[model samples]
Target: MHIADLQRLITRDPGRPRLTWYGDDGERVELSGAVLHNWVNKTVNLLVEEFDAAPGTRVLLDLPPHWRAVVWALATWRTGATLVLPPTTEGSAVVGQEQDRGVADVDVVVTSHPTSWTGTSAQLVAVPLPALARRFDGDLPPGTIDAGSAVMTYGDQIGWVEEIDPTAIAVEPALRHEDLVTWALACTPRPTASEPRTLVGEDHPLVVLRRTLQALSLDGSVIVTSVASTTAFADEPERLDRLRATERITD
Candidate 1:
């Protein structure tokens, strides 16, 4: 359901906004269903054409609660690669616990902070979180790909598709393609997914990721916060209220 579900959502309503992101730096980006599908396709091409990612490939996602993270998730799934999400930002319980794990531990490292991966063999794809940016913010390491720019050059339509087994593991935490939507729905509790729900929240990174997937699977929209809402909105009540009203974040 991972790839097929996304295709259906984009086809059903190409112009409806699917993802609305809110960054800690006051950045906001809204991608319609078609736009979201394009990003996923381009990233899928980037992974398959540039990085040679395919089934059984393990791609590590080292990112915060951002829109690109969602894009990477869909793209990784589209390629039938295992999405390796470290339980903790540093390192935690992965399927195979390595003695010393860094960003280099996986086949590809998708992150904004690539400095942590020194002398690593994995393909580093540096991503800039800003809404409008051509490349990653500073000097990226020698071999790192500037994802912001590289993704733009890729074809908007997915050129090829891999035959994904419904039972194959698509994510690190042992989520299979057949059960991905069911698992995500369990993590995110909000308005029924059948309607146009615009959910906003501050949850764990994994939970937030799951929530985004749930929204996509169920034809809903999501607004994720870069920082926990409590922290980012602590000093700005009016800002919070305005956003809630604008996005129709009703309980």
Candidate 2:
């Protein structure tokens, strides 16, 4: 099934918030189901009609952790396009990996940090989130196409680019237990995803505190901190400061 076709779920609940982007500046951006559907549609149009990107095209994504990255990824999937997520920051390591892995001809590169890729000599294009946002301005684009149709249209558009044979890209589909725990900690309490506190087990505050200390053991600066919470969690600001002041991480 075309995963991008998931847009159809929006019609059933147009008002439900489909995406919530928490900014580093303490700003929150919420996109309702209907709004997200429209943004993806416009994104698809721009990719196909403007950039000539289509299904099977290998697009590279080099973006920071933000809402725009989420939208761009989904939009690429919607177009049946293969996506390459480079390391968070650009450097020789990222370039060497893409080359060693034979991922040349990266059609596009969406990035917020442009200087990181200077002198890479790749066909890289910068597609920043703010710029893409200006394309729609919290409004829907003109189109009567449904989710399934969009995927088919995208597939056809890519077919004209080159006589490219269809092939599956290698990807690891499973996450290790520790990796899963790390991922779970990054999540906040939300309806769409798991509850963060659910991972807080037996030791109550102590377990979390110990885990936080363990997380710091690897990298002294690696600290667990909370944003907004009424409950007394181990990673609270006060505890983090105490740990830091005591040189718990320095050692």
Candidate 3:
């Protein structure tokens, strides 16, 4: 299945919560299919209009498992741009590999922290992690795009989509655009689970992205905790239990 196909399925129940996030600072946010789509659409416009991203364009997502990070993934696929996560960031925690050697061909870098843009020549798009943030209040690096705030200015509906090669790599770990949905669906929950409501405690953005895909594949939902709050639910068994019960988690 393709990204558009998954999007159609999501909108089938637009109001049903698709992803729920808990931040380190005691912040909580929920995204239904409709809401998620809106964010993704806005981001798609940003990538396409700002950078002319399309098939073969490589965008490096350098943020953690925040809601904006999720939107980046969705938008990248929609644009048919290659989402070059750092091999480990590319593959690990934030789904990106770090350093100049790692991102040799990256055309754009979307990051929350741009310590020094000198490390890479890729266009920088700085994002703030806060859910309600109207903009990135921090001092932005030279030639940086405050995407967190610019996202609001972009048209919510995607202006267009590129027709990409189905065989082209859409995500890392060699996931092709055509095979992504099937790959995600293959990540089935345990046999006893039904309408799986997954709990992703890990802080890795790759883990969050993978779980999100798995939940969608299973026609399930997910509850994710941010990097700072990984231990929030774990430290309180009672609270975790209450959360599970409230969300009706099957696995």
Put down candidate 3 lDDT per residue, 53-147, tens digits, no spaces: 89888888888887778789888888888876664433223223345445667789888876544456678898888866878878776888998
lDDT agreement with native, every candidate: 0.76, 0.43, 0.76
The C-alpha stretches of model 2 lying farther than 4 A from their native spots are 88-98, 119-123, 129-251
Please report, as a residue range, the 10-residue window in candidate 1 with the lowest summed lDDT: 91-100
Tell me how far the alpha carbon of residue 117 in candidate 3 is from the true structure, in angstroms, after superposition: 3.0
Steric clash count of candidate 1: 0
lDDT of 1: 0.76
Better of 1 and 3 by lDDT: 3
For candidate 2, write residues 1-251 as lDDT tens digits: 13333466443567755444434323446666677667666666656664566554666666544445555655665565666666444444566576665556676555554444544545444444442233222222122122222333343122233221223331112322123224333533311222111121222222332332232222111222222221233446694355346433332
- TM-score for candidate 1, residues paired by index: 0.88
Per-candidate clashes come to 0, 0, 13
TM-score of each: 0.88, 0.52, 0.89
- The deviation in Å at residue 164 for candidate 1 is 1.4
- Please report how far candidate 2 places residue 55 from its true position, in Å: 3.1
Candidate 1 on 1-251: residue-level lDDT in tens? 56766667666888988888887567788888888888888999999998788877889888887788889988988888888875574422332344344323478878878776545567789898888587888877798999989999999988876767778778865778788888876763655536445555555556677877766666778877777554667678897788888887643
Report how far residue 147 has shifted in candidate 2, in Å.
23
